[model samples]
Target: MAFSSGSTGGPMANINVTPLVDVMLVLLIIFMMTAPMMSYPIDIDLPQRSLNPPQNLKDPPPPISLRIDASGQVYWNNSPTPISALRNMMETEVQRDVNNQPTLEIDVNEDADYGLLAKVLASAKNAQMQKIGFVKK
Candidate 1:
């Protein structure tokens, strides 16, 4: 603490920020030293090769067409198929080609029941069918 020599004022009280700056610097250094040790390397078995090939290399399999009419009837490949058989049919197709799965193209009528469509989608998913698409028309 220093006293003012001027005759106007006695001793000026001022905040000493040097100690605060020193404490902040010490904390910053501590954090910097410990931050690197906090992170640990994790090991994971990542896939080395992509399962799918380039699109141009091979011809894609023909998509299986599934249609839902306004009367809530489901058709597989233009033939009437019962909802109960949908899962079996999809599983058969998957079993036929283990490497290449057939894509499913669904055509739902505008007036078709939403529940029917949902059921069909759920069935396809349950059978582990991945490539499902919707037709605009």
Candidate 2:
């Protein structure tokens, strides 16, 4: 509480915020002291370096090649395979290695039809083949 003192005015009521400010500062200090202690350090066992050479895991299989000639003819593994067989072939290849999916490399001729290339990509995706890359001649 505060009062106004003047030559010709009555006493005026005013709120003293000093106590509120002190309480807020105390609460801030309490939070700052306790915030750090609230967190606990986690224990972890990290991997150690070994002197022996690392053993080779499963060898990566050869990438399956799909070639599209200028005339829009599609070839699977250098052999003529129709567009209809692409999905089935891709599915079988994926099933062969369930753990590591085989990579499919599409080699498209410079003059190959865009529609044909799109169809090939769609077929590979439909078969759930994840690793598909383009092979530039």
Candidate 3:
């Protein structure tokens, strides 16, 4: 018995995937060749500490709040105060109730002028208010 091929688009034959496999293999090889160079490696060596007991330090408590609003305005403990009057006020406050434990906490809004903030910090430092810190609000 002889078998006859299908009609229409000539003899119906199984598609050979060899060419497709070869193309895919070549692409994979090309990608492999370029991949290593495409990516760079980073090497880092972290510092190691000696095995010893850590020293303990007491954290100061929340300080007196000094707020600076966006318009370069200063607030002494939430109340607006003029820059001309700030230094004296801070001095007085720091000296208030000697046993009050002096510490100044300056909180500044994000839009507040940094120059004004620096002046505030400078005033605090000049007044000898030892502990000063800034808080974002």
C-alpha lDDT score of every prediction, in listed order: 0.90, 0.89, 0.75
Any idea what lDDT model 1 has? 0.90
lDDT of 3: 0.75
Model 3, residue pairs in steric clash: none
Task: Please provide, for model 3 over 38-57, each residue's C-alpha lDDT reduced to its tens digit, 9 standing for 90 to 100.
Answer: 99789865658869844763
Q: Which is superior by lDDT, 2 or 3?
A: 2
- Candidate 2 residue pairs in backbone clash: none
lDDT of 1 by residue, 106-129 (tens): 999999999999999999988888
What's the number of clashes in each of the models?
0, 0, 0
> What's model 2's lDDT at 105?
91
Mark the regions of model 2 whose C-alpha exceeds 4 Å error after superposition. 1-56
lDDT of 2 by residue, 1-137 (tens): 44667775767676778999999999999999999999999996676888995576587789999999999899999999999998999999989986678789999999989999999999988998888899887
Mind sharing the TM-score for model 2? 0.58
TM-score of each: 0.58, 0.58, 0.50
